[model samples]
Target: MSSIHSVTPTFDEQVPFAAIKERIVQAMCAASLGAVLLFGAGFASMETLHNAAHDSRHSAGFPCH
Candidate 1:
């Protein structure tokens, strides 16, 4: 009878490359979205921006009147 041997993977080989790539893509997308929102709000009219921020604050139960 022949005996079979099992092999264990190292730390670097444990995680798949596809998972790492996905995480990087997600982080980059989030950063890009934040930049766009910040610049867009900065260039928006004062009244419109204030109203939108005010509504958001109230919806979140934060008083800023």
Candidate 2:
């Protein structure tokens, strides 16, 4: 009598390298943009923004500038 052997799949064969790298790059870009927006939003003072040539506090209100 003869017996059959079973084979196991490898990690390299299961996943494609190009697809994985593309996803990673996309996620990194999104994270970077979010971080930049968060950093700019942190400064809520009118003087600080305008003095730095931005003036991002409350969008030209009576108290702004």
Candidate 3:
């Protein structure tokens, strides 16, 4: 007579909270900077700056026109 046995794998690794917090902070900073730049260019008062931004949108196929 023969018997079969099953084995299970175990994961014991842990992620530190400080590393997670750092990543979250970095992501938030990046998003804030991107928003500032995008809005700044979009609402620029200077004709040259606004035109440059508009041209960039058209070249990138954003269909701003």
Candidate 4:
């Protein structure tokens, strides 16, 4: 005969709220920075700046075409 032991973790053990909040904040900041850079290029009025972003999107498989 064999005996088996089973254990389950509590809700708090499954996920930490602080870590999730930190990750969300970091993601938001990164997205905001990218958005700023994306829009800021328009104000610079440089063709290269605009094309660089366009090309990067295509390379990333964003289907810009």
User: Using TM-score as the measure, which candidate wins?
Assistant: 1
Instruction: In candidate 3, list every pair of residues with a backbone clash.
Output: none
Cα deviation at 38, candidate 3, in Å, is 0.7
lDDT tens digits, residue span 15-62, model 2? 689999999999999999999977886865767656655443445544
Write down the lDDT of every candidate, Cα atoms only: 0.93, 0.74, 0.88, 0.85
Cα-based lDDT at residue 3, candidate 3: 92
lDDT of 4 by residue, 1-65 (tens): 99998998677665679999999999999999999987887576678876887999988889765
TM-score of each: 0.67, 0.46, 0.54, 0.50
Q: State the lDDT at 36 in candidate 2.
A: 90
Q: In candidate 2, how many Å is residue 33 off?
A: 0.6
Query: Which stretches of model 3 miss by more than 4 angstroms?
Result: 1-11, 50-65
Q: Select the stronger candidate by lDDT from 2 and 3.
A: 3
Candidate scoring better on lDDT of 2 and 4: 4
Model 2 steric clash pairs: 49-55
Q: Can you write out model 3's per-residue Cα lDDT over 1-65, one digit (the tens) per residue?
A: 89988787667767799999999999999999999998987777799797887898999889875
Clashes of each: 0, 1, 0, 0
Model 2 lDDT, residue 33, Cα? 99
Rank by TM-score (best first): 1, 3, 4, 2
